[model samples]
Target: MKAIQYRKFGGPEVLEYVGLPDPEPRAGEVLIETTAIGVNFPDVRERMGVYNRAETQVGGVTLPQVGGLQVVGRVLNAGTEAHDHLVGRKVMALMSKGAYAQRAVARADMLVELEDDTDDVVMASVPCQGVTAFLALQVCTVLRPGESVLVHGAAGGVGNLAVQIAKVLGAATVIGTASSDTRRAFVLSRGADHAIAYDSPHWPESVLSITNGKGVDVILETVGGDVFDENFACLGMLGRCVVIGSTRGPGKPLAPRQLMAKAQTLTGVYLPSFFQRPDLIQRGLRFLKDGIGQGLIRPRVAATLPLSRAADAHAMLERREAQGVIVLDPRY
Candidate 1:
């Protein structure tokens, strides 16, 4: 099998594309012939040795391990928990590791069935970003009809999905922030009612202007750091701010006094932890499937690179050159 493996923790250059022995199906796991791989930020973090502060294996540093997190493929075999129905079924999985390869072994329970008509790339985009967006707006907060939403980094993978799903969840006005005119336009085309440039210093005021001086009801904040203060400023009285990611790095410490003064809520969302709550996962998966089935959740695959070009994909993401989800096809 062909896989992109990193022998050392460093930049994109460390990710080497080479041949490797096929991974075997472990007990309670399924061996998948990967069709599509979702290139995510965590992959970059893992490659750069920032995912978890753990000791690395000497030399090869787990040579067979790959960096991708999500994959869409056909299940070839299951090692345990016999389910004849799963064999050869088209499915999408959220694997903990090893997705940047022609074959991936994922826990059977982590894989979800896909409709025949569902594009592999689209399903590949769903598991990680989809789950987070869905949980933040609907499952966790329960966005009400006529409520307003603002999604930071709204043109990126999770942000774009948040923009589209906010409307489906009954948000009356959806505002999204992107870095450029092209990205702002893309966010608006994805169903957001308002689009603001993230680089503009007064973007928060612009949100206020669009909302008629009242702030938005909900805010999906992924870009943290200096801009986090502005995000809190844009939250309406009695509004909810969901912190999803801190791509801009850690922001200033939260002040409890501010929340108390405005009677607002600040919530932190991590999808991996949400898995322990099966109810949330079940409801979220249903919402994801329905959204994809209804054409409400469209995929923005700006580029599909081969597994060998994994380094280029990382460079594109780190440089902020890609508009939407950058995917990798192992078959490519």
Candidate 2:
């Protein structure tokens, strides 16, 4: 089998497309002939040696690592027990590592069966970003109908999905933040009632005016740093803020005293930790399936590049130049 392997942690240059022996499934795992690999922020962090949740508890990553985070493929074989029924089935799998290859092993329980009509590349984007966006609005905050919403970085993968989900949940006013005019338009097209530039000096003020000085009822914040500070300030009384990611750097301190004054709720959403709950994972999958079937949510594949171009994909993502969700086609 051929895959991209990284011997050391650094830039995209560390990734080398090379040949490797196909790995067999362990107990409760399935070996998949890869269809598509979902490219995500964690994959980039792993390549830079900065994503090490396992380092403190388990151990640092092993060398010559394969770094894709989500895998969509057909089950070639299932190891042990009831999993045998999974053979020959198409699946969307969530993995911690080793998906940037033609063949990868996936935990049997972590996968959801895909319908024959499902677009393999699109479903490939669902496990990671799709689920994160779904839970962020519905589960994390429990956004209510007639409530207002403010989504930061609303033109990116999770942001785009969050915009749609907010609308589906009946958010009365959905305001999205992007860095440029093109992205702002993209956000509005996806269902945001309004789109503003996050870089604007008075976005929070803008939101206040949009909501008729009442402020918003819920906020979706993924970008950190001062952006978090500004967005948190926009929350209405008794409003909630869901922190998804801090790619910009840890935002301003969350002072309880500050929260007490506004009666606002501050919460964080991390997919890896949340995925540990089997109930939540399965529920999220059901929501995704129903959403796609109803035409309520459609994961976009912004760019489809072959696995050999994984390095280029990483670079484009790092530069924030890619639109929608970027995926890797291993068969290419």
Candidate 3:
């Protein structure tokens, strides 16, 4: 089997496509023949040694790692203790590591059966971004029907999905922030009531205008730095803001008194924490499946690269040139 591995993290050039022994399932695990591998922003962050997570650390050192989290493939075999229900099934799963390869092992509990018509590319894309969006709406924030919501970085993988989920969850209006006219148009087409460019100095004012000065009831914030600073001013009284990622920059000062004044809630979400809660994953999968079935939520594959070109995929993601999800075809 061939896999992309990096002994020391630095940049895309650190990634090396090399041959590796086939993975075998251990007790209570299943082996999957990888078909599609999802390329996420975290993958790039992990490679650069900047992603914050416990799994990103090992033996007090985080180097020498294989970076990939989500995969869509067919079950090739199962361990003795694995449930008999999974053999030879088409499934998608979140792997602890080692998904950018021809074969990988995963805990049976993390695997979800895929419908025959479900695209492998979309399945690979959904586990991380879709689950994040779904959990943000359903768990982190208590959103009410007829309330407005705002999504930052709305043209990207998670942001795009967040906009649609906000709509499906009964948000009266969804405003998405993008960087360009093209991305703004893309966001509007996908369900955002209005799409504004984050680069504009008056973006927050635009968001307020869209909500008729009441401001948004919820905010899905993926971009931090100045964008976060601006959006914080536009959150309604008692509003909830969920911070999932900070793609822009890390350091930003906040006025705690302002949050207290409005009784706003600022929360952060990490997918691994939710992994321990299978019920959340199940609910998210149900929503994703139903949305796809009903033509309400569509996961876009921005680009597909062969497994050997994993380096190029990382390069695209790092440069922010890729929109939606970028998939790796292991068969290639």
Candidate 4:
């Protein structure tokens, strides 16, 4: 088997494509021949060792790690008879590690079977970013029907999907904030009612104007730093703001009293924590699958490179060069 791994944390240059012995599954797990692997921002952060310094119990990857969260593949075998039924079936799986390879093992219960016609590269982009977007809206904050939503980093992998998923989940008006005209346009194409440039200092005013001064009812905030602070300027009474990620790094501290003024709520979402609740994980996967199946949500694949170019994929993500998700085709 061939895999990309990092023996030491650093830049994309640290990722090495090398040969390895085939991985075998343990009880309740299945071996999968990966067709496509999803490249995410966290993979970049992992390579840089950002998670290692985090004070929270989130996202620390060990040295010499394969460092990927999801893959779309076909089952090759199973460890136990209980999971034998999965053999030879196509699946989209979420894992804690080891997905950046030609083959990987995933918990049998963590996979969702897919049809032969399903696009592997696109589905490969779903498990991490798609589920985060879904949970930010549907679980973290419980976006109500007819409510307005403001999504930061609206052109990003998770952000783009969040824009579409908000509409599918019944948002009356979905407002997206991106850094450029091209990205803002892309956000609108994904079903956002309005697209504003978060790069502008007055962007919060634009959000207020869009809502006729009432402000949006929900906010999905991924870009941290000043953008996170600015979200409060347009958060409506009783609105919910769910922090999904901090791509720009953590924002300044907030006073709890600030939320008291509008009776608003603030929440944070870490996808790994939800893994403990298989029921919720399955629910999120089903929602994403159904949304795609019904044509309500579309997961975009910006580019597909051979697995050997995994370092290039990481570089693309680090530069924020991909408007949508990039995938790695291990078969190449």
lDDT (tens digit, per residue) of candidate 3 on 1-332: 99999988688999999888888888878989989999887788777766545654422225566678889888888887446678888888886677888898887877788887778887787778898898898899877888899999899888999999988889999999988899999999888989998889888888888888888999998888888888777999889999988778754777677798889998878887876887778678777877876888988888999999999999888787887788999988
Query: Which ranges of candidate 4 are over 4 A from the true structure?
Result: 54-59
lDDT of 1: 0.83
lDDT of 1 by residue, 1-332 (tens): 99999888889999999898889897878998999998988788778877446543212225435778789999888887685579889888876688999999887767778876779887786777888888899766778988999999998888999998988878899999988898889999999998998778788899999999899999888988988888877789999999998778777898888898778988878876765665666567667878888998887887899989999999998998877788898976
lDDT of each: 0.83, 0.85, 0.84, 0.89
Worst 10 residues of 1 by lDDT: 55-64
Q: Residue 321 error for model 4, in Å?
A: 2.0
Query: Candidate 3 has which clashing residue pairs, if any?
Result: none
Give me the displacement of residue 234 in model 2, in angstroms.
Answer: 1.8
Residue pairs of candidate 4 with colliding backbone atoms: none
lDDT of 2: 0.85
Two-way TM-score contest, 2 vs 4, winner: 4
Clashes of 1: 0
Badly placed stretches (over 4 Å) of model 2 are 52-60
The whole-model C-alpha lDDT of candidate 4 against the native structure comes to: 0.89
Top-lDDT structure, candidate number: 4
Q: What is the lDDT of residue 176 in candidate 4?
A: 92
